[model samples]
Target: MRHIERQIVQLKEKILRVGTLVEEAISKSITALINRDSALAQRVMASDEEIDRMEVEVEEECLKILALYQPVAADLRLVVAALKINNDLERIGDLAKNIAKRVAQLAGEGPIDLPAEIRTMATLAQEMVRQSLDAVVNGDTALARQVREEDDAVDDARQRVRRMVLQGIKVEPERVECLLRVNSVSKHIERIADMATNIAEDVIYMVEGDIVRHRSSDY
Candidate 1:
């Protein structure tokens, strides 16, 4: 392999490492929330720094490849897609961190009934993130499109959570603050699903050279 080819391989490995960290972060955050494990939540918050560092590393590698190789055709698309996907992954990490923060706060609020819809939202969002990364690694546009379709399910779950929260607040007026925190978590998970969709869209662009952003239905 040529020097640029070697660099590209290294770049792919780095991005996959970042993705693995992010997926674990998301999973741990949700587990923290469900179990009200404050220590786990704290760990998730602390690990955000590592995800941030890795994101910067990935972006720098992309720029180095672009500057040194000035690759065109598929190579150019791959580099550009990696840059976009890196940003999305970092933002997903931030969202997971935000979820962890909420979990920490909720842990101290005594016993409260967590909504089932929130769990559904969390599961869908996590699946989306995993599938999106898989789509990128395999250059699978079909899997990418499936991720896009799954985003709608997450959105629906978010809406269900919203409704449940409003009813919960009405029924247990004293727990208004706790319900609001749950609402915040639901919103964050919804945004995470959005980030996953964005990554999936970038995968399609990388593989098929198609700009499918804002055209999820057409996909």
Candidate 2:
């Protein structure tokens, strides 16, 4: 293979590695929240630094490829898409860290009940990340589009979680703080799902040379 081709493959692998880390963080954060395991939450928070380091490394590799190869057309698009996807993956990592922090705050809060809708939202978000990364690795636009469609389900679940939290707050005023933390957790998960959708869109652009940003519904 040519040098530029080799660099592109390396870049793709780097993005996949970052995606794997983010996915694990999201899963662990949810597990921490559900199990009220502060130790697990701390572990997730600590992993964020590794994610940040990988993000920087992937970005530098992309820049180096661009500077040295000066690839045109499809090659250039792939590099640009990798850069954008790297940013999105890093943001997802941050969201996971935020969830871990919230989980720590809610620890020992007397086993607060998590709304089923929030659990569903978290599951969907995790799936999105997995599917988005699969799309990137396999160049599967169809899988990417499917991930985009799943984003709406996550949003709906988020709304349901919010409603449940508000109702809980009305019934048990003392649990207001706990419910607010739950609300924030749901919001963070929803944001993570949104970022996954963005990554899927970037994958589509890279593979098909189509612009799907701001056209989520058009998929």
For residues 1-219, write the lDDT of model 1, one tens digit per residue: 988889988988899999999999999999999999999999999999999999999999999999999999899999999999999999999999999999878877998788888888888999999999889888999999999898889999898889999998899899998999999999999999999999999999999898989774564
**Taking the tens digit of each residue's C-alpha lDDT, what string does model 2 give over 29-148?**
999999988999999999999999999999999999999999999999999999999999999999999999998789867788888877789899999999999999898999999998
Ten consecutive residues with minimal summed lDDT in candidate 2? 210-219
The lDDT per prediction is 0.92, 0.92
**Clashing residue pairs in candidate 1, if any?**
none
- Cα lDDT for residue 72, model 1? 92
| TM-score, per-candidate, Cα-based | 0.97, 0.98
